[model samples]
Target: MSDHTINLNKAHFTISAPDIRKLPNDDGIEVAFAGRSNAGKSSALNTLTRQKSLARTSKTPGRTQLINVFEVEEGMRLVDLPGYGFAKVPLEMKKKWQKALGEYLEKRESLQGLVVLMDIRHPLKDLDHQLIEWAVESELPVLALLTKADKLSQGKASAQVLDVKKKLKPLGGDIKVYGFSSLKRTGFDQATQVISQWFSQNIENTEESDEVAE
Candidate 1:
């Protein structure tokens, strides 16, 4: 079986943090999922975990309003961040969420990496760039998933993936990207591999730190 198969399926909902202060104790390694409104963020999480309802898929945008946490193991988590660019949400509430997300991205020490989703057709919009900029500033590793790849032909999907990689190359960080399709389950293994590698690297780093402290 694949490495992520067991751990991802073992994932379970932990808590929802409406604000940064409400987040769980900053002790475990976390990888967050971020995207614009209706960009298939929730679907990607569900697909990764192999749980149909784990992340709560919805037809409406901006339904995910909090930082939803899922425990994959004793000290590992998957965070579902609020989707940005929801015009229907109130300005004040949007700002509130933005503040929380920004703080979490900028200050959360346990956050090991981020998985950003974007529609294959609309690869990187303005808000997506803004988020990428934040990740660049944070010096955080990232895996960009182009969602809804089933909407396009194989050649087109491949082209889109290359296009994204070309665009993100200059950002200057450890970033791996792939085309993902929740419907066809394409790129599932690649996505899982990225997750496994990132989590394992984090564990290795922690072990090295502990050894040095001894």
Candidate 2:
């Protein structure tokens, strides 16, 4: 039961590890962001942290090949996983990135939440569905962000969000769907609130565990 607040704006770059072995000691709460190559994951991250270039946006869709870590504070981190479902990359290279992503997702003890970004116009691709399903199966909370929402009209965007929600409703897990626009800050408040709550909930859980041990 601590009163401290989580501030994503204070996030700072820590490391970009090619593999999970190179990541910091797995002792803290980490919320990971995962998406397709053209899903605007970097832009969404930059918006979340209120930094112009915090996550390194690129003209090339699959440029982010490593697992980038940022620290919001000690024991609280945000991870940017390698983009998936990019058709332009070499088959061998794509396999490697997928391997890294799978390893991180399966083995990372600190992962508390997952933020899955997909283009509003073309969401829930095969890989995206697989990732979200896996997260739900693992009982992990998820925030499904339909990125580039500004590209669509308000009515269309709202319809898209509802459609996604309806499709994922059967999973029966802790999942949320929202339309997000990094360029216009759409869903920014809801996104931040959900992510902050995840961190806070993890902190409370850790505290309870410590008390029980004592």
Candidate 3:
């Protein structure tokens, strides 16, 4: 396949659907970003896209209660999934968000990859593990970002990345782990390249299948 690169910086808001049913048609390639509340997911997304307000970082956790969509190009999109594990929210609201997240993961046919962000200091909570396991089971590629790496010393952050990798190695899926910091721009290139490659690979695969059908 050619070295096709996706310009994530060109991403623009498409829709903020309350649930999967309200999203755009399940076509093209979508890479979803998911994480616990307060994981700096919005910051990471803004850094990746070079757009300050694209994903809407909020001072309060659980502010993002919808499935946010941004289109990088015609057939390439980035999704900011609802944050999980925010205890301050009401139980019913939490359940609603969880239901939407679960439905999207299980049913979205255009979902080609998952980007699971976690605070580097507190990596991989129970919900994080569950999400990763589900993606692995579904045969979806995952790019696990250990966000807020700048909060830790380089040596400590590197060690944490290794530890997380060691733990996840047994899952035996296409999962890549990296220490990422939206503030420091740590792992920015690596993260962008991985996500871009996902889109590029999906396009190439679809093209090949179409050629075969001809």
- The candidate maximizing lDDT is 2
Cα lDDT over the full model 3: 0.96
TM-score, one value per model: 0.94, 0.99, 0.98
For residue 54, model 1's alpha carbon misses the true position, in angstroms, by 0.7
- Cα lDDT tens digits for candidate 3, 19-127: 9999999999999999999999999999999999998988998999999999999989999999999999999999999999999999999999999999999998999
Model 2, 1-214: lDDT tens digits are 8766999999999999999999999998999999999999999999999999999999999998999999999999999999999999999999999999999999999999999999999999989999999999998999999999999999999999999999999988999999999999999999999999999999999999999999
Q: Please give the distance, in angstroms, between residue 72's alpha carbon in candidate 3 and its true position after superposition.
A: 0.4
Residue pairs whose backbone atoms clash in candidate 3: none
Greater-lDDT candidate between 1 and 3 = 3
Candidate 1 accuracy as TM-score: 0.94
How displaced is residue 200 in candidate 2, in Å? 0.4
Measured by TM-score, the strongest candidate is: 2
Candidate 1 residue lDDT tens string, 19-108: 778888899699999999789999999999899999998899899999999999988999999899879999999998888888888888
Residues forming the 10-long window of minimal summed lDDT in candidate 2: 1-10
**Segments of candidate 2 deviating more than 4 angstroms:** none
Return the lDDT, model 3, position 112: 98
Local distance difference test, candidate 1: 0.88
